[model samples]
Target: MSDPNTADCDSNLHASYYADGMQQVETELVENEQIAQSTYRLRVAAPTIAARAVPGQFVMIRLAGVNAPLIGRALAIYDIVNNDQGDPTWVDLVYLQKGAFTTPCSQSPVGTPVSLWGPLGNGFDPRPCDRLIMAVGGIGQTPMLLLGREANGAQAFGRPNGWAKDVELIYGARNEGLLAGVDDFRQAGFDVQLCTDDGSAGQQALVPAILEQRLQEIGDTASVRVVTCGPEIMMEKVAECCQKHHVDCQVSMETPMACGIGICFSCVAKVKQADGNWDYKRTCVEGPIFDAGKIDWS
Candidate 1:
């Protein structure tokens, strides 16, 4: 039995749309010491998507057909940006160079025509909370940008939710060089924590370590509700840490997707349902955002 109301909410509140594949006319390389990741901010040139796209979502990208034919690449919606010409010009599909396909796609210089379809996946539920903590690991921090935007969204010209006083972000990378875009979030007024594994810059530890340290600094474990996205180990560690401290946590899980839609179960994740039975949820549809406790990372 399905609840008609919930189904309506999913249809109305959580809707999906197709964004046309556009050429990457521009590529800005964000280089740091630990990793050399290039970001390709695709110019969608389509106004419809720009107006409706939400945060914590992703797009399926088809690499330029150069040599061999391959399936499309799915990239997180790093930013929910607007077009240059203003109101309706389009959206930007930012890609973090991470794999073989991404590597070639990275080399394809500006003006390379590629296929893209998205604004896919279920994003975070950005309702009001007493306080919010966002934690990111590696390139996984990309989606945090959108979460920041959502937190700062206005229904018209004023803060719709009237979000409360505290907002924090914990970011991780190998060295100072790998910690790119920390400044952007900071400029947006997030209490940003930078951590590295090699003691290069910021805090000398992993993100989970810094997060725990921060929680200790605050000393109020129960007030923090976390939103996290990162490596499996980092998320698991963070989740465990929060639980140990009695903090409520929400995590964004990233799994490989075949269709970038519900048709393919490749991106399915095990979730503990209300009935106490575990069910598999497609990350493309059911969620990328879920309560940390409901997930059995084991």
Candidate 2:
């Protein structure tokens, strides 16, 4: 497969890839509403960034002039909202307010000046498949919505048409209050399946077990593909289940990042080479999205 990070991060809104020349803009926060328990959906006016963003991509954001936390926080590009003229105007990000950056960010009033950069990292591959299963846990569902929209023909990103015959989301959270955007996924035509650890949502089972059951029901492994994000342990289990069923799987790594660009090695992930040796690859540039089989999950 070709390197997904080589695409131009310019004004080519419909391009299949984006990279290197990502824009850093001084934009103002439009809205920051709490969508779920401790989860806030932040909207920022970043036309240039939003115009080039694809599903599974992320942005580094910080409150302009805030020095207590000097480094920007990496947040997934959840969705893009267009204006009446059909021009991409703002980008939305959903985040759990648990950390230093996020807690303060959530408290910032609307219209606060925000500085953000991106359309960074390699996004999920929009290739066609018979069935696309999104295995998610915690706040991992943030990036899956746009992917689902593209896959179900409701929106277009890199490709012009919907690529999957069907899309199902197996989302798991601690409880019902943490299950953000379930209705949004359903609205986008995904077969929504829910699971929670505390039995406060759809099923009491884990996400990987639910994924395994779905894989078994599908039977035809070649036609199925799985993409997972969330806790590493959960993703590891999802990857294992996909491998056991001979199904192709992709993972969106949530490695801690300092810079959205590849200059900092802070977001490196272990990737397996063809020669059987594993090397560190920068998640910011090489991927946030990687083939599950190529990852050295150890």
Can you give the TM-score per candidate against the true fold? 0.81, 0.93
| Model 1 Cα shift for residue 232 (angstroms) | 0.8
Residues 1-298, candidate 2: write the lDDT tens digits: 2233443222122224335548999988889999999999999888898888888899999989879789988899999999899998889999999988899888989989989999898889887898889999999999999998888788876455588889999999999999998888998889999999999889999999999898888877798889999999999999999999998899999888999787767987888776777777777877889889888899
lDDT at 234, model 2:
96
User: For this target, which candidate reaches the highest TM-score against the unseen true structure?
Assistant: 2
Q: Rate the local accuracy (lDDT) of all candidates.
A: 0.65, 0.86
Global Cα lDDT for candidate 1: 0.65
Pull out the clashing pairs in model 1.
21-116, 25-111, 33-177
State the lDDT at 178 in candidate 2: 96
* Clash count per candidate: 3, 0
Could you give candidate 1's per-residue lDDT for residues 1-298 as a string of tens digits?
1244552222323323322222232222222122234544445454444455566667676654544437666677655444465563344555566677776765665556666666666566666766778988887777777677556542211124335346788998877777767776787778888888887877888888888888898797666678888898899999998888888888888888877766766887777666666666777766677778878786
